[model samples]
Target: MRRVVIIGAGLTGLSAAYHLRQLRVEADVLERETRPGGACRTTSRNGFHFDLTGHLLHLARPESQKLLREIGIRNALRSHRRRAGIALAGCVTPYPIQINTYRLPREIRRDCLLGFIEAHLGKADSDTQPRNFLEWVLSRFGDGFARHFFIPYNRKLYCTDPAELTTEWVGRYVPRPDLADVVDGSLGLYRKRVGYNATFLYPREGGIQLLADAIAATFPPVRLSCAVRSLHLGAKEAVLESGEVVPWDALVMTAPLSHLAAMTADLPAAGRAAAARLRAVAVVNLNLGVRGPAPRREHWLYVPEERFPFYRVGIPSNHGAVAPPGCHTLSVEVSLPAGAATASGLRERCLEGLMELGLLRDAADVVTVDEVHLDPAYVIFDAARPEAVSTLRDAYRAAGVALAGRWAEWKYSTMEDALWDGATVARRLAG
Candidate 1:
């Protein structure tokens, strides 16, 4: 029997454990936090339940949906009526940008429509490699749409200019609407919603934590509150915190690559240098308990203006039954570059933004505020990112340590992607 230790206990860690149990592999999970879910935990305060962020389960592939069903939580899944819009120049536009062109000012709308037509007329004969996120957005949606929506939204969400980021991160994360859909949308004739995230699933009772907890429960050997400080990677052994050394033929690490580098202090200087160059965006989630139901029609609202500190706002009450009746909850998500700002400052800015946007109306509408900071929430895919990530990954592989999850893989991934990565790690270990 092979003994495996999984770190972090997030959706990825729990999924890995669950899959390992299915294979009858011996495994133990070590989580630094007292709870299992890392960023997906749900907490209740003063009769209001709040997730770290409003997590809506939207699977990119059928295999992911199948896995959800296999976990038996599928029966508990309820799909939300997709209600989302982008707040631009004090007006709410239908989300996915293309479907709601009527919300924009007449001139702006005409320009956008014309740009779309021109882009189609000048369509390339062959696929041109996008130099950056800006080029990618323009190439896909034209300059008008890119400047009006994609650029501002992405800048707020990633805390960096789109031009500084790579285009590889755009795959599946952003949807490209066809010319017919764009025309129909412009003519107010499009009936179908635009993107894959139009409708998403959530658990009936516990929110997304249900999925993580269920997976963790399947593997009983998980150790909680065990923070891994360092790793002593040898030819046939690995050691964790509390001086407990576990001998293993192989090791798998799902922790952030930066943390992994710190763990393997004995690695070559070049490897450590490459790891240091890898940058990540930290996220501050301000969960606010509000009076009554949500004021908007959508599950989420995107802020593309500089007036708002948060790039996106999610109302759990709009999507799931987790929030208390007569009381709604909003998760204000602000992405900050690492060391860019403090959580308190960011929270205050978000509140101010909410006031300016008229979402909060008055200070009295706020019942409670719970703040959570998720470090390394986004991996910045810059020109140097691929090289840095590859070097670190190769170094870890050479040292016999497995890497998985968003930060581990250094990809801008959805929750489904993280779960898939975890399951893949488990299969490799099981085999």
Candidate 2:
């Protein structure tokens, strides 16, 4: 029997272990944290439940749906037609601002509509082939939409210049409205939802940790608080903090790729250098349990203007039973470069921004405030990302390590992708 060891009992690691068991292959799961569910875990504070950040499930694959059924969480997860919006130019507009710009201020609306027309009418053969994210946004959505929403929102979210980013991560995440749709949107006639996440599934109660917990229940108990001090790839062994040597025929790493590189004791110089080239932004997730009901009916709002400290704000209470009977939960997300120092009074600034945007009434109404800082929250897909990720992954695989999930694979992805990656890696190792 081949020995298998998985690191970081996140959704990906837990799913990998579960599938491995179904395949009749046993595996050891190690988690640095005392609890499972990485970012999927939820914390309860003063009767309000909060996840690390916004984690909604958008299941498009039959396999993912089937897995949910098998794990007995299919019914526990409820579907929701996304009620999301964008806050800009002193007015809140429906999301995908490309097609829903009618509600925006007159001048902003005019700019967006005219820019779309110009981009569409003056488009050339070269315009269709965007070299970077900036070019892609300019070509596809035009200058007005790009300037108003895409450029500022993404820049604030990714914490990088749009031109420095690549288009590889923008496949279906960014919706492309047609000329008719754009025109209808400008006229406030476009009502069709047009994105991969237009409709999503979230846990009815107990937060997203339910999915992770259910999957873990079907597998062997994961070793909690068992941190891997370093990886001896040459000897095919992992040295735990307690000095326990866990040898494995295959190792599934669901931790950050940068962490993997930093922890490996004998990785080649080129592999380490390639890993170092990978860049990402961190998120400061401020979870608040306010006194009153949510001010907005929309589940979340995208904040694009530089005046706002957060790129996005979400009302988690709108989607699930995460809040108390009378109170609502707010999930505010601010992005910064990975390892950057979090500024003092940032939380105060976020509250002020929320109030300024009319999302909150008074800071004194706040009950509980929780903050979570996630490093490498979003992987930066730059021009060199493809070659760098490929080189590192190939090198690690050759050394008996398989990277899984968003952080390990080093890309932008959702919860469903995590499950898919886990099961895929498990099947490959089982074979």
Candidate 3:
């Protein structure tokens, strides 16, 4: 029996433990937090329940479906009604922005439609590679869509210009509509919802955290409040935070690659330098409880206006009975570059914007507000990201350490992708 140690106890760590147990492998999980589910945890305050951020499960692969079923929460899953919108130009437009371009003013809509037509006619050959996110959006959806929605939304979420990011990260996350489809949708000739996230599933009782908690429960011997201050990977021993040392044949680490690099004092200078180049974004979640029935809609609302500090908002009561009756709870998500500003300032800006957007009628309606700041929530994928990630990966492999999860892999992945990565890594270790 091989003894394995898993760190973090987030979705990725917990999933790895669950799969390892299923395969009858001996394992122990160490989590710095008292509870499991790093970003997936949900908390209740004054009769309101809030997830760290609104997470919806929308797996497009059969393998993901199998993993969900294996976790025993398959029956509890329910798809939300397809309802989402974007706040643009003081009006709410249906999500996918392209499908609802017709809702714009006549002049603006005409400009967008004409641009789409012209770009479609002069389409570049498929063989040409898009140089940046902006180019990718224009190449796929045309200049109209890029200028109207993609550019602004990407800026809000990424906190960087789209031209600075790479396009290989855009596939499957962004939908590309044919010229006929765009024209028809804009002209009301025809319409369709296209994207992996169009429909999503959530737990009926607890929020998405239920899935992570369930995975954690499967591993009974998990160590809580155990932080990994440093790791000394010797020829046959591993040292942990409490001055305790444990001998091991192999190690699998799920900590952020940047943090891992900082811990390895013996790592080559070149490896350390490459790790410094990897950048991450911070996310702040402002969970608010309002007095009202659930919002008229279930899907999240994307805010694209410069006036709003939040990029998106998710209503929990709309999901089901998770939120208290007659009280609406929402998660307002704001993405910022690391160390952009203080949390208080960001919270104030978000509240003002919410009031202006009518999401909050007034300050009086806000029953409670809980702010959560998550660092390294997103990895900025630029042209250099591939090289940076590859360099770190090779260095870790050489040290007999394996990396997993979004931070470890340094890729923008959905919740399903994280779970899949965890399970895959566990299986390989067990075999």
By TM-score, the best candidate is 2
Report the lDDT tens digits of candidate 1 across residue range 121-234: 666664677789888777778878877888888887888889998888766667777888887777767778656687788887756888787677666857887888777665
Which has the better lDDT: candidate 1, or candidate 2?
Answer: 2
Each prediction's number of clashing residue pairs: 1, 0, 0
> Could you arrange the candidates by lDDT from highest to lowest?
2, 1, 3
Q: Report the lDDT of model 3 for residue 241.
A: 78
Candidate 2: pairs in clash? none
Off by over 4 Å in 2: 125-128
Candidate 1 residues lying further than 4 Å off, grouped into runs, are 63-66, 125-128, 235-241, 343-345
TM-score of each: 0.94, 0.98, 0.94
Q: What is the TM-score (0 to 1) of candidate 2?
A: 0.98
lDDT tens readout by residue for model 3, 176-257 = 7777777776766655677888788888876777888767766685788887777665553555678776555556677788
Please report, as a residue range, the 10-residue window in candidate 2 with the lowest summed lDDT: 121-130
For lDDT, the strongest prediction is: 2
Candidate closer to the true structure by lDDT (higher is better), 2 or 3: 2
In Å, residue 310's CA in model 3 sits off its true spot by 1.4
